[model samples]
Target: MEITAKVPETSLKIKQKAIVIGGSIAGLLIARVLTDYFDQVTIVERDRFPDEPQPRSGVPQSHQLHVLLTQGYRTLNQLFPGLEEELASWDVYTLNWTADLKWLLPGGWSPHFPSELKTQSCSRNLLEFLIRKRLAAYSNLEFKETTIVTGLLLNPNRTAVEGVKLRHSNGTETQLTAQFIVDASGRNSQTPQWLKSLGYEPPQETIVNAFLGYSTRWYEYAGNEPLDYKALYLMPRAPHQSRGGVLYRVEGNRWIIGLIGVGKDYPPTDEVGFLEFARSLRNSEVYEAIKNAQPISPIYGYRRTENRLRHYEGLSRFPNNFVVVGDAVCVFNPVYGQGMTVAGLAALLLDQCFKQHTKSNSNPDLKNLGKQFQKKLALANKVPWLMATGEDLRWFTTEGEQPSVMTRFLQWYIEQVIFLASDQAEVYQAFMEVIHMTKPSTVFFRPSILLSVMRRMLSRHHKS
Candidate 1:
């Protein structure tokens, strides 16, 4: 393996151990961050990574389509400089969010225009492959693959995490000691249960399920036809129509077609049913794009689409030196395409907390580290959680807490804004910015956007 950068061992020396569970994107990133503060960072992964970009047992959704939002794209570059260029070398496509993509909103088709929100388009497998490869550069990092983390090891008083109990594939169990344990496990994480086993109360969970399900197929683009855009999204309308689909360019001149259904409407995995479901989408773009395309892979189905927030920050009593990140903390509805980006942000937050702790004291007290990081992570997750859950609530069949008056009002306002965005380029740009996480939600409340929304709402009301 090629060494990325040789760090002077004496420059950043600390006699500490940090263990990160799960070697997915989030875990790898956490390991990267820990290297600066810890003497050794071990990432325990359930599956050995593939030599190249391919699916693995741990990440079931590795075959699915994924895009890095503008913020995530930028953050990744900051973490691993020239990452975008490296992906390009591997044939990952970077498409303009608005100009090179077509969107079919409930109101109408979104107007095409140039915007700063450029999206990094590629398969989840390819992205993970690149991240893992980059992680190989750190001399202080180590990965113990094909190992399962059974539980956490706590101190004598059970006040702080001491390490983790690991079970090897050969059925042998052992303990690895660490000053800090970071859980980057995905949606099926067992952190809550592990915490409860140690006599600590588990974080309360908030689930909003739209019963969303999807079927995806990989296709090789037949160079015979000319394409109008690099990607396309046909959104599902709530209450009445619940079918949506997206077809986008990935690596190797191939495209991924995923058809989504909400409220228990599931896309079929069989070929005949899959094509029929794609054809039945509100817009014909996705179906048309894939109808004559060559399918390189079989249809795969995924159904765990609930937006689950494990409210770790709300827990009054929590163990020190143990913190959760990534989907282990919050799993959003995947159709919103926020998982990777949110994970990236959480890793950034963890890095900040570590830097702040190191700067303030020569020997920082690590007992309260977990609680402080959890609270900060919760604040970081607030906006994305609201955006995802609010949209999920639009469907009446969604299960979870009832929408508050404030939520309902904001939802109404956002729906109007979406309508205005469909026609106006400026409004669409602002909307894209908010969704891309580069701008705050308050951008939608700007005077220009608000006036247009009111004008459109009143005009429609008068017409009706």
Candidate 2:
């Protein structure tokens, strides 16, 4: 396998090095940019990597459908020039943005569907293979598979990060040194433990988990036709039960669909049982598709997902030469398909911070690095968080945070907006744009949009 490597065109040499303690998307991305900043960049992973584009058992969400949001795509293109070209080289599908998608939201169908937002579809394994292959080309970067870091090595002051003490599959222990260390280990990250061992303050965290369960499966495409499909979302009303289903177009000429619900609402893994789950979504298209599409794998289920946030930025005493991004920072509901995109954005943020630091040869002060990155990357997650959890929380009543009247108004308005979008193409596109994060969620507040909403409200009132 010929992995393509890119070298920055510069004479400035890297006198220092960095170590990334995870080989997932976040870690890979960090290693990718570090090649330009460090003399040596090493990525440590506990799982052994496959030689091809196959899912590793280590990544829980490997086989599922991973989406590339518009903003994330743009950031990736900026960071890795010719990214789309690379994916396309391997036959990855860059389907029509919003114009071509048949996006359905709980409110109804999206408005201005095509004009509003567009998405990229592909299996996670394939994309990961291609990137790893390309990134391996970096002369300064190296990967250590089947190696796990037992803990961190701290200096005498223990105020700064230095390196990691790791144990490999062979049961041999080694100390890997680096000037900078990043804990991209994600939701299960042990950085907290390492910090405590060093007598440093632990990062503050906020967990908002309500125990939502879900199941997913993928099917191979059997034909070439327009996907004028409905995304059946069995959602909760202002004060109703929360249950939903989502179907997405993916690479390999296939479709990936998931059925999700809170409490007693999750879909079953049995073939016929899963079909019934689709049927319960109050849509014919999803069930129809399941009956027609060829199954590529057995039904897969995931319930370990919980909304977790480690606010390293909020800590008054963070390691000077360290930073954390991706799931290690803030992870949202995967049903929103924002994880990968958020990781891409976090990678972009890392690039900006490093580029400035290396360019000016500064001390790499990180007092606000974690906070700034968290705040910046979080801007992408706010809408999706509210869209997914806010709805789910409504299921058990007295379960979620009390929503304000404005929240209820927005929820009602969004439903109408969705219903209109499905019927009116212009509305559909605009709704999609906001949901896909292509446009700000506040776009609905624009003067023209408000007029349209009032018209929709009046029409609904008249019909009632």
What are the lDDT scores of the predictions, listed in order?
0.87, 0.70
- Write out the backbone clash pairs for model 1: none
How many clashes in each structure?
0, 19
Q: Write the per-residue lDDT of candidate 1 for residues 244-307, one digit (tens) a residue.
A: 9998899899999989999999999999999999999997888888888899999999998899
lDDT of 1: 0.87
TM-score of each: 0.97, 0.88
| Alpha carbon deviation, residue 429, candidate 2 (Å) | 2.9
For residues 198-264, write the lDDT of model 2, one tens digit per residue: 8887877755555566778888876655555423334433444455666766666767787776655
> Candidate 2, 435: how far from true, in Å?
2.6
- Top of the candidates by lDDT: 1
TM-score of 2: 0.88
